[model samples]
Target chain A: MMAVARAKSRKADEANNPSSQVLRFGADKPLILEAGVKLAPFQIAYETYGELNADKSNAVLICHALTGDQYVASTNPVTGKPGWWEVLIGPGKIIDTNRFFVISPNVIGSCLGSTGPASTNPATGKPYGLDLPIITIRDMVRAQAMLVDHFGIDQLFCVIGGSMGGMQVLEWTSTYPDRVFSALPMATGTRHSAQNIAFYEAGRQAVMADPNWRGGKYIEAGVRPEKGLAVARMIAHITYLSEVALHRKFGRNLQDRQKLTFSFDADFQIESYLRHQGMTFVDRFDANSYLYLSRAMDYFDMAADHDGQLAAAFKNTKTRFCVVSFTSDWHFPTEESRALVHALNASGAPVSFVEIETDRGHDAFLLDEPELFSAIGGFVASAARAKGLA
Target chain B: MSVNSNPRIDLQVVADLIPDNAKVLDVGCSDGELLELLRNQKNIDGRGVEISQRGVNECVARGLSVIQGDADTDLVYYPDNSFDYALLSQTLQATRNPRAVLEHLLRIGEHAIVSFPNFGHWSVRTSLFFNGRMPVTKDLPYSWYDTPNIHFCTIRDFVVLCDEVGAKVEKAVAINANGQKMGFSMPWWFWNFFGQQAVFLLRR
Candidate 1:
């Protein structure tokens, strides 16, 4: 369903003149990654709505998910779609951008304006590809912190995200406890589960198995791995939704035909819909960046870093936390959120939790779920009051 | 008197028991009226555990820290002495094991505040005595088969359970049918028969 916009030059142009502001850090201020590598002379592309108050306490950092970019509440220049979280963020919406200064940064390892596998490497004058040092969730948060520092925001009013973005939120609260006033990590977990790693492995294999992949050097080859990346996107898309959501959207109904044409073509409506999702995703997302971001999610285990105690990761943290999950989200289920709440309780952190009842599954965080909106709105308002914000 | 004044009376009593700047956990805090009251009046840091998703949502929308959790199964996740007070208002009887849940409350907080409808009130006793069936009054409005109050207890019974569980009653208040407090010097049986509901403050 998407126009073919997979050319290397088009993506490079997006990197050069991103739709939003870009913050650059020279070799003097290198980002020390968790992988024991230093990434210098990098830049972070971000979008800002609303104004930072005099005290700078009104800033809210919005971290995007695995494939999400910095276009949080504006139009994306590449795909021409509305910002991913426009449903919950705007002038008078749930997050209330009119009052709170909202900042959304394209992560360091994503295919967006950020320096990812698709960005030109300073050393070789080519796309970093696999040469880009592996980035972790901690690494992504560290890079965003530099952007926050650029604005002179000592502490963010709130840090919010779902799925992979949620992982970054947790990392911010854990690593830089004093820098965040409040945190909302929804539809996520402390560590990637075995099942999550298995699903991502299947998607990564799909990308690598295609002949056009060229061993992660497809951009230099002048032929993108369209089929491989499409298959990978399709595999990951199924995990984002629940079986009930799939059934409700597309049951056993045929794809615009009187009877089944069972010849390996798109016979079922679900098949056609999945194909559209995959095809649309490859146009905007880079294939090798997908592999790197998913691997970063796989390596995220906060508890392991803190001597096998998740509570220890948040020791003596004064930041208020509000954890949210969906009932039908088996990908990152309510049980995972409960585990996070339990850790926060053990650490004596001010925390609240809610498990929203919805059939929409993990993607419910991104959809028009009123209950999620109310929960986030209420929590944000209360936190704002606590911060003495008008 | 209007009907709403009475419930407010006991809730006010629960709010009065807490001090300023205290960390409070309101177990079974349906919609968080009591916690909200404490937060506004006493300036206490309040948290809540509600059993229903709807109740939890409503509580959160009011800016109260609430989680959807069953009192029977979820209290074990809390650390010891985490709060200044833990409250179980009108929700103790609905638990599967009221004794164990009470023990958990005491363990999780420095003090526990409990409130429940007394089954030995004259109206409840008279209904069962004359009708020869489970009582259904204004306070206890459900039949035995459909009632969520499975582990029902009277004022005297709760006091005995508190003693059995090694908890000392720091303070106790009994509210009569008209939402008036009974005499403080009265014996347990007098409050058990005359009082409609009771609120107790206990500590280990």
Candidate 2:
């Protein structure tokens, strides 16, 4: 009877949200998640590029940041924009598609065809809403492990990501020390700072206060909390940029005019930019998924797992790490990355760090900056040669 | 077609000084040119510590073992006697602390080979005397303000410092800027008057 109800609930979700693309895999099959709650009949959405070698030693797993889906190098049907990291994941790009078998999965608690609040509950015949068990970054990694197993890959050549994606990269190395050969965690922290959590809380409050939220049951009512989600996106977007970048891009500039209109109509260029950002973001992302993912980030604390010693977390790791940060990124400053490097060095792990100079803020990792690209390109190439992958 | 075949490196000189099939570490190993020559031509196991990511990448791409690290900070990571020789050809003057770094290098490897531009060369002296400014010669291209060569020393100054620090000079080879051997039969004053660079093999 439980199986029948789960099938019915899945069918309802399918009717409401159509898949942008089919989920495909190789010979080995997906494993059931082991978080105690049986997502028995749950499915993961992922995309792959390049061919798997006969020895299967060339696979690289890319963990995506918050609001990123599995379509890494493909078109986002909703936004019609190129893949979030198309610059870094093509045929001859740094993470070369021709040489690496790459896999990127839509993380759990996301809206891109993954199990989340929008996913239906088997028992209630409705959305999970507030009923879904709270998940942590480690839980997301555990789910990804199931996907890794499905590919029959025992070890990954490298696990790469940035920002929230970087959190998953660190978790991969810590949780599965023997399974990762190299890790590239860029523009990220070992734990979210108190200030970051405060911003997340503000965004959550904005979404929850909306009348259309309907106590997290707006899905059944056919109502969308667009206004609150936009506000939340606007606030979070400010954190993604650096003060230097803001000053350089839009410093006291009037919006499409030489002078202010003397009214509250987004007269400043920065305000207009923020409004566009908020409006465009609401077109694709689910408000409830945003709340859940941010909460997951808030709960992440790598040092807590090692008896309050950050070095202890990496004591047994044999994985070579390349921890990168940007100089202008106040979000995850170079100090945080240096702390991770220091911890790795204290634990006797082979680690390297590069704090690249750039005004692109935290988003520098995603852009086509020549220096960052060259650094990553060079590091991966060197690691590949060391592993005999070249 | 190997990059090691460049005319700039004194292959025969470095070859005679470096023992065959020895563990070697080279600093400022630009493009892994010298390390590759040592590995393929001399049967030595070579590693390097380079500051430039591109240079380190090139080394690795050529199948060389090199770490991307600053010699200023990363040298302490290695244990004592980690290599048979630590080669710092034409790179010693560019380091942050030439004296202290040489001591560390000698402690890390059984022998250390250091080569640098002799600031007391006759052409430099002539240029400074006549022009009344820092000389921009063939070897040291940058002016005083922008030059990375912070610890420029004359051959006599380096020898005196080595003696003061109790470092034994195993072998010394003075060469002109074009990498030709200088005749040792001449007086020290005459040699210092003409020699452009000097390479020294030291042991503690």
Candidate 3:
């Protein structure tokens, strides 16, 4: 019964009640997307921890990655699991909720209580599906800026994130330089590379190729593209991991039987693990949302918007930046982060660049990496000192 | 401890040369001790380029602006005369091309301060003459096979390179084994024979 209910309301229900605090922007304050579409009656769902100081200068914005919601350091109502970034954000953790007011919002165009393709279009009184105007990283950040403005926070103490979230962080700095005192953009680049675009294209193709996708109207048809979305998730999941990590975790290990089945069954533990990953993802994520979000990432090119010089994007910016990359993260390799650091340097911005020694690939930022913790912890403490946060 | 024998004193000499509030870049800034010192004491805007990941991490932990980059390759990215002072301490010998690195330092900063161990010191010459093997001293700790100091030079050789690079020496100080600077009146041959290390302030 629970699975049936979850499957039925996979799209609209979450757009209404996604398990946390939500902010509703009426038609009077429509979000003007970069594509020149004004989205009215939009809502931004978010979660906050710690208390805002009397001066309101201690607020930190934590941007979520693709498919990550606002449940930064708590339980997820849909997944029944801990928050994605709970490892680094707790009372005494690296982010240290006790010290700073951390606000994590579900970015616009994502399906977790934020206005996305799954939400009702209001124009037709039905799910927007593919009708929703395509959202860019800048659009997502602009919505977040409105959310921050609602709190009367003139300047965020820091803005931090990894992967897609990291892209948002860069956008935040570029779009509103004075509003961000410092930024930590980890495991991401200033622009998505061709390889990354190819991977995302493959995922999008898998979802569209499914018969149940119904021309992206699956939610209205009462049938979800579970099989296609699962395949997409499986393909994307592989990119998030490295060959070393894969070898270390499931080195040709069989799943229950001693020998191969010689059939189309999940013979290897890796295959079984990927299938489980795919199935669980389909339960909480929207297929159209995935297509939209991946498309948004592919369109991210900060340099192109700034006269083709990456340094021009940060000309005379005062925000302090710390760019980090993992040694084994092939998805967003160390060279990408180096490019960002070089741009920041050329622009005469105060920046610190560190490439951590890790075998955990792009997901290392979300794992128990002591070096990463120390680097972030130390950086935050120093920035806090500089910001005069007691 | 004498200025030439103590690494800390070597950094102090380099630190003493720069004026307060100057924009400085420390190439090969290992762990950022000099940059931190300059930031705190001189109140200068400081940046660093360290080749080692471990060193870069340590610098970031201290809240110093640093990047994981080689002095040889990464220095070209900076625009000319971007910094008031460029410092190279105890690291010039390790660079693949010392002449090019020195030229870059001069080009990137209006003034460059460099300090290096003098290979023409009496002890290094005697060690090679008697033992006929590479010299191992308190300053140069590594054996010849494992040494990172690839290009060793004397005080006179450095002066000649400065001339070749078209850098005018504003100030030059040669320190002996006793941690004291040799007399300024002494000739280049005398300082080359007795001086353990040398520090020079250069400008184009």
Question: Best by lDDT, which number?
Answer: 3
Error of 2 at B73 (Å): 5.0
* Candidate 3's TM-score on the B chain: 0.94
For candidate 3, lDDT tens digit of each residue in B71-190?
879888888898999999888988999999999999999999999988898888888898898887666678889988899899999999999999999998888887687798999999
TM-scores, in order shown? 0.97, 0.77, 0.97
On DockQ, who's better, 1 or 3? 3
Q: lDDT per prediction?
A: 0.89, 0.78, 0.90
RMSD of 1: 2.1
Q: Check candidate 2 and list the clashing pairs.
A: none
Residues A1-390, model 1: lDDT tens digits: 133434456676666557678888889999998889899878889999998888898999999999999999999988889999999888998888889899999999887778888888889988888999999999999999999999999999999999999999999999999999999999999999999999999999999998988999988887788888898889889999999999999989999898987599899999999999998887888999899999999999999999999999999899999999999999899999999998998898888898999999899999999888888888999999999998
lDDT (Cα, 0-100) at B95 in candidate 1? 99
Tens-place lDDT per residue, model 1, B48-125, is 999998998888888888888899999998999999999999898899999999999999999999998887888777
Per-chain TM-score of chain A in candidate 3 equals: 0.98
Local lDDT at A377 for model 3 = 81
In model 3, which runs have C-alpha deviations exceeding 4 angstroms?
Answer: B1-5
Weakest 10 consecutive residues of candidate 3 chain B by summed lDDT:
B1-10
Docking class of 1: medium
Q: Is the docking of candidate 3 incorrect, acceptable, medium or high quality?
A: high
